[model samples]
Target: MCEIGGGMNFKRREFLRIVIDAIDGKTESIVVAHKDRLCRFAFDLVETLVNRSGCQIIVANQSKNAPQQELVEDMLAIIHCFSCRIYGSRHYAKEKVKAKRKYC
Candidate 1:
């Protein structure tokens, strides 16, 4: 299953389905072009769970440069996530202050 979103989001339905299928022994194997393509973090944990359930994760590329690229991607994703949260919180704070002013 291909996911357009960043691998950081574990709440994704496709990702969750794959994990459940692997745990249930329904999925024999999961193949990805790169390690981070499967997940950005906690890959070892997932691999262990899959292996325990008789499933395997096949990573086709193990290049030295892959980790560097994955790191860049992960950093960017983290910044974007935090920036969105900060912006949302600022908007909410403004709205709350406005409501208080109107009430006063």
Candidate 2:
């Protein structure tokens, strides 16, 4: 089933209820636009259900269809964050030392 992820009134209750019904043998197939669309990082549980209960998952957007540019951009953003963390800490320490010392 298709559903919107986030908004001021975002609700995940329907998703949970669907899962419960699937567990109870009411539904066998689940189709989603993307795994991340349902939740940012919580597909393990659904995979576990597939393993245990033999329910099939059909993802509309396969990995091969995903944009390469988005992956590269995400990687660049992560690198930028880590570089800032490392250099920002060093800069803070240097400034702190400069404040304490009159001359070097």
Candidate 3:
């Protein structure tokens, strides 16, 4: 529940419990420091699910950044991530090409 939201590797016990409670009409409100803190990549999905269950979500520290600025930042982050992955595998690709050339 207190784990970082970088990836989906962590065990989300409390989160699942909350969602179940929401579905069963047990929980009324879910407050968090930020919407993404509750779910990094699935906030919209979770919100829709809980909303249908009559549960309300509240973001304490709402983003002050403009929508355009946030979009640009998100795009840049994605590009940077893929760039790192591609460039990081350049050495592996070079090795594979060298091995294929040796076989030829």
- For residues 29-95, could you state the per-residue lDDT of candidate 2 as single tens digits? 8787766555443466665775466577677986654578657755675676578779989999999
* TM-score: model 3 vs. ground truth: 0.59
> Which candidate tops TM-score?
1
Return the TM-score for candidate 2, rounded to 2 decimals.
0.50
Q: Which residue ranges in model 1 land beyond 4 Å of their true spot?
A: 65-77, 84-104
Ranking, lDDT, top scorer first = 1, 3, 2
C-alpha lDDT of residue 24 in model 1 = 99
CA lDDT of each candidate?
Answer: 0.87, 0.65, 0.77
- TM-score list, all predictions: 0.68, 0.50, 0.59
Show the colliding residue pairs in model 1. none
By TM-score, rank the candidates, best first: 1, 3, 2
**For model 3, what is the alpha-carbon lDDT of residue 86?**
96
Q: What is the lDDT of residue 18 in candidate 1?
A: 92
Off by over 4 Å in 2: 7-11, 65-104
- Among residues 3 or more apart in sequence or in different chains, the pairs in candidate 3 whose N, CA or C atoms overlap within 3 Å are none
Residue 81's lDDT in candidate 3: 60
Location of the lowest summed lDDT over 10 successive residues in candidate 3: 1-10
Q: Tell me, what's the RMSD of every candidate?
A: 3.6, 9.6, 5.3
Error of 2 at 91 (Å): 33
Cα lDDT of model 3 by residue, 27-87, tens digit: 9988888776676566788889999989999999998989898788667756776787799
